[model samples]
Target: MTTYFLDRGGRMTLPGNKFHLRVDGAGGRVAIDVTHRDHQGLSSGRRDRATVSRITQRTIIAAVPGDGAPVFRDGARVALFIESDDEHGSEPLTVEVVQQDVGATFRAELARLTPVGNRIELSVRAPDQLSPRALAAFRTAHELLGARTRPHAVADEIDIAIDTTASMAARLTDGSIPALADLIAGVSRAAGCDLRDVRLLGPLADSIAAEPLGTLADRVAAVVGETGVGIGRSTGVAESGNGDDVVLVVTDAPPVERLDTGPGVRHLVLSEEPIAADAPAQTGIVPAHLTATAVTAPTVPDQDAATLRHLVRGLLAALAARA
Candidate 1:
């Protein structure tokens, strides 16, 4: 058996012997292409055709016929195979099976790291072993064929808005608070942004004695324990009119009537259950556009946590890309 490594646009030819194949990658998924051609020259008039009879994760079976007569089965392994034979059987007849490796493992790893619901901006460095053209194709696939997300500038700052209300207690207890804190750190590092400059915002009312907004910001700071600006009482934050600012609001269902502002806030509702549609507006918070993202609490299933993490990461990525 002959083993061939495929580049972005490489091709392979197969001998008539039966063959076996195996593919390994991070996601364990690969794309396969198969084509067949006919050889010239024959002794009696004959038309040649090849048929792929079976396909699986690791194997392919095909039948190649000569002169449109009896069919001969050819077994092949690997992701894809091509079959063809010489009409006259004089040119050392054989079939060509091409295998191209698209770096599914690398793509899967990237996907794992990518957050769901967010735009992804990819910066791919060519592997030393691969050519520039191959890398370019890989990048094209990532940008065009894969999930779509906007790309952001590497050095841009991301403003994170938090919702500090009685509702946040659930997130704090459910583990979403810490998980979100870690996510923020990862995003800050990946985007080359200054986590120190990150802004935290929440709701505040003179009626609340404990200053839940301030306390929430402190909790977020303690969870991240990183230097960043904390702003409570939404109206108190300096209005810079900076389009670069990203407002991430963490909240539970609050009545819209309670909200006193809505110009620059985006909502991240954390709960084991979905937020109600008529949930009250967070008081004194104005979001330019309110985008609702969900984070899973401890009460959520493990699978849901994974799903929510992926989604939140994607959302953050998208927000970062916008910057």
Candidate 2:
């Protein structure tokens, strides 16, 4: 089976069909009604009866009934995201609202969000839009099984931060630095972003050029390879500013100094160390953090290399959604 994993607020393309619900978060009032899609009649599997909700954050899920739960399948794209309705204050988020009526309450609150929030919908099977988390879960599914008719789309304007510290010397021994650099460059290229939107910051390299993935990777390897690891203030990354909706941080050592990520900015982090529990997830949708500390692969020559693959795939999934 394809390994499925992702940050809390991750999103995936629904090739088949997903529920289209309407929620108005205006004046503390809420209403969520399932608006069927064209393929509803064809989705005869238990999957057709599934429900995935996004209380307040984004991560809208899609799946089918399986070992007591719904499994993900291709088709029907779901359109249930969150934005402020401006008239109200905020809304709720729930992945499963079927077992209870919490989804109804979530719909009411979602309807009241501010800044004229988008139409609210869901794909979950349970309730209590308010999970123990502030973010939703995307569980980034890997590549498509076959030809993709629709390209993956996510938030526009993204910012990526890579920490260049002495801790990265370990990666050199494992030949992971170059691999990581290549992944970073590839994501930007695949996103078809303006060269300027792709920002690179580290203890060694710094630039905003729209270079080819290979060239970018080479530059990263040279700078970081020569610089090695050390305890230094990554001022460049800190000052890069929060101009993008999504910011991805890739590093072995997170900056200990000043790094200002705007309040509205969504941050996704991939690290070699463990992340603190308090770091917000889904600052808008789902979990936005990953730790390679406990993750390993027996087949890979080195654990760091395997971890690099996971990080790359996860980042790619998020970037594709944002693109």
Candidate 3:
């Protein structure tokens, strides 16, 4: 018999119409109605079910019944079947399974990072594992922000600050292009801004001619492909200057100096990985009298472009909300 392992948030895709519910080895069919009480006497919703499946070791056949297809929703409950090797007088074992919705969990994190009401600013810190998801949620929040500013004249422009250093070569080849492309798409869609308006700062600025904001996105992609230059080690700021409500900083490492802040410059930090716990304290050039918000995206998965896009969308939403 082959043993299958399922963790708290593990998932298994069902091929066709074989099964009605996804199953997990650990938690039996997850339900949506369960709530957990925390230390503060407050109850919060926790994972109801985990979704997963097992494939036969020898044949690689899915262990689900009925054509082996998936038939469950994001939070459906399921069952596990254990077949006995010995046919005669054998005892059968069955267990319950649950499905967990990763998308839902990601949205919840985004909600926590967003602030409510007019002109409120907030910062976010996301674990590297969740950065992509967090960024996608941020983009969603951006649309919501636009909705809030309907009466007031909101600016569609954003100033982007990127780090340029020699080490960026690896990130440029590996992940930065895709990540930036996703960001450009998300910003364009969420803020109703033309792609051409998105500008590249520094030496790269001269290499690519500034075109109509509508064409800026394509130009940026082309530049990324040709030069293969990644956001280097330098740190700069990206601001939607109209209201000074958002500032985005993309860097592989921490800033050498603290950011300068004004009424509207809400600080956000995006990194390829988490800052080391024992790193020395940041000093110098702190933005005077303005609170800063930071968000990080450390690892962009090599095999998951869709997830990466979703993450970028989230970041855009979050920034839009602030605007």
Please report how far candidate 1 places residue 176 from its true position, in Å: 2.0
What TM-score, over all chains together, does every model reach? 0.33, 0.37, 0.34
Per-residue alpha-carbon lDDT of candidate 2 for residues 130-240, written as tens digits (9 for 90 to 100)? 111101111112222112333344334455555555554555445444444444444433332222333445445555442443354455556555655556545535342
Instruction: Please provide, for model 1 over 1-323, each residue's C-alpha lDDT reduced to its tens digit, 9 standing for 90 to 100.
Output: 23333332333333222222222222232322122111111112221222332222122121112212121112211233223222334233222333323331111111001112322111111112322222222232232222333223322334445544444554444445434434444443333333333333444321111112213323554643332223334553423244444444445543354442433334555544544555432222111111121222324345544443454344444344222
lDDT of each residue in 1-323, candidate 3, tens digit only = 33333333333322211112222322122222111111011112223222222212111111111221122222422333322222233332222222223221211111011113311111211222222433443344343432342222222334444444454455445445334544444443334332223334334542333233334435555665565454433223343444523434444444457543432332233343444544432111111101111224533334344444444444444344232
Error of model 3, residue 140, in angstroms: 7.3
RMSD to native, candidate 3: 19.2
lDDT per model vs. reference: 0.32, 0.34, 0.32
Model 1 misplaced stretches (Cα beyond 4 Å): 1-155, 197-234, 238-240, 258-264, 275-309, 317-323
Which of 2 and 3 is the better model by TM-score? 2
Q: Pick the candidate with the highest lDDT.
A: 2
